[model samples]
Target: MGLASASLFRTCGAYVILAGRSEARLETARQRLGDAQTLAFDITDSEQVTEALSRLPEESLDCLVVTAARVTHGPFAEQPVAEVREMFEARFWGAYGLVRAALPYMRAGGAIVLFSGVLSRRPGMNCAGLGAACAAVEALTRGLALELGPRLRVNCIAPGMVRTELHDRVPEERREAMFRSTGESLPVGRIGAPEEIARAVLLAATNGYMTGHVLDVDGGHTIRQYATRQ
Candidate 1:
């Protein structure tokens, strides 16, 4: 997700800084991006995020985009407590902490683009906790949009299933069929690509009037899925 967005932003003449928990990944991104910089830090660590922001040469950041999320799909009754904790730490608390730390470095006219998932509003078996976490992001986006308005614009992009590394965690038995079924189920008749979602992320970040909104870039998945559930 971050890589796709970074590529788009970088291509369009934005000086990009890639941040993540993996030095290897960051190094790879720096090589791929050629001219961009990379910062290695755990978003869940407030101190680390603050230190990272401090290292930036710019006195004020123009945009902040939080696109990190990991979710495990399994029956709620069988879900491991550790994985659930990891999800909240990475997906929810990580965004919360980063924003709190990064806000100090961003001036008015700055914008925040958050990532949410279709499962937030379209529940599925074995995804209750994952859905809850995404739903929290949606709520947080709206709340921050309202509270930070006139200074900072906040919004979320709720994307449908995109072909990304995140899907490697889906149970092997379900993985292949899940994508097939999702492709057939969505009104667009296909799962999304990372670049497709990246386009929407760019819009949410650059658009001055869009705030406090959960823009659905789900290819009609949420609404179509909802209809099936009923």
Candidate 2:
């Protein structure tokens, strides 16, 4: 989703800076982007985030779109406490710290687009930890929008299941089957594409009056349960 957002922003003639933990993957993505600056850092580490942000060449950021998260799924009882903490460190604190650090470099009227997931609201079984982290992000979006208003806009994109490399860890056959079944179950009759979610990020960034909003780019995943109800 980050890559897709970067591509879309680049297409719109924006100078894009792509940040992630993997130098190799960031380089590959930068190659695809052709004109983007890449910063490789562990967002989960505050020192690293600060150091990375310090290296940005631009004087002020017009928009900051964050799509990095540590995703974990399992029953609450079965989920390791350490793993859950790690998820929060990466997903919640990472975003919080980055935004705070980047505030000095953000131009007035700039936008900060954070990422959550549909599970934050329309949660399923075995996703308690993930849901909590996502919910925190959404809440932070609203709070920050109110606190930082009239200068910087803050919003969140809560996307549903999308086609991304995040699922590659699963066996290919199983992954495809999961996607197929999920796509069938959604109201749109298909899962989301990364590009679709990217479009929402663009909208949030460009729309001046759209602060403190958690825009759902979920392909109707949030409404699926209600739609299926008798």
Candidate 3:
């Protein structure tokens, strides 16, 4: 998701800095980015974040988008404690750390776009931890917008089940069923693509008038209150 967002921003003439734990994947993305900088750091580590930020010129960022997250789905009793903690660290704490580290580099008119999920509002049976993390992300976005007001804009993009490598983890039959269910349930009649969410993120970053907004790129998933009866 970060790579997709970075590609979108670079296409729009922004000099992006790619940061993540996977150096190989970052390099692959960098090759596509032409001249963009790549920084390998774990967002969960404060010292690493501080060190990485130190490498960048002060107040050099025009937009900071945090799309790092982890999702674990299973019955709560069956889920491992370590897995739950990892989700919190990746989805919630990592985002918080990035925001804290990037704040100084963001000047007036700059924007920060964070990613959440539809699960935050419409949680499922096996998504308790993910739901909580996403909810926290939305809350943090709102609070940051208020606290960082008038100069810097803070917003969140809550995406529906977008087709990505992340979804490949589900069993093939289950994945198909989920898609079919989403198509039947959502008014838009299909799952969204990564590019669709990327466009929304770009909009949030570029639209100077918008702030503290939780934009749902969820294909009306949030609006459909009742399942469609066939």
Which prediction has the highest lDDT against the true structure? Answer: 2
Measured by TM-score, the strongest candidate is 2
TM-score, model 1 to reference: 0.92
Candidate 1: tens digits of C-alpha lDDT, residues 1-230: 88899899988888888898899989988999889878899888888888888887654678888987677768888989899889999899999999988887786898999998988988888999889999999999999999999899999999888888888877877987888777887888888899998898899889999999998898788768534321
Cα RMSD to the true fold for all candidates: 2.4, 1.7, 1.7
In candidate 2, what are the lDDT values of residues 5-60, reduced to their tens digit? 99999999999999999999999999999988988888888888888888865447
Alpha-carbon shift of residue 162 in model 2 (angstroms): 0.2
Candidate 1, residue 127: Cα displacement in angstroms equals 0.6
lDDT of 2: 0.91
lDDT of 3 by residue, 1-230 (tens): 66788888888888889988889988998999889998888888889889989998888888999987888888999999899899999889999999988888887789999999998998878999888889999999999999998879999999998888888888999998988888678888888888889999999999989999999998888887586736
Lowest summed lDDT window (length 10), candidate 3:
221-230
In candidate 1, where is summed lDDT lowest over 10 consecutive residues? 221-230
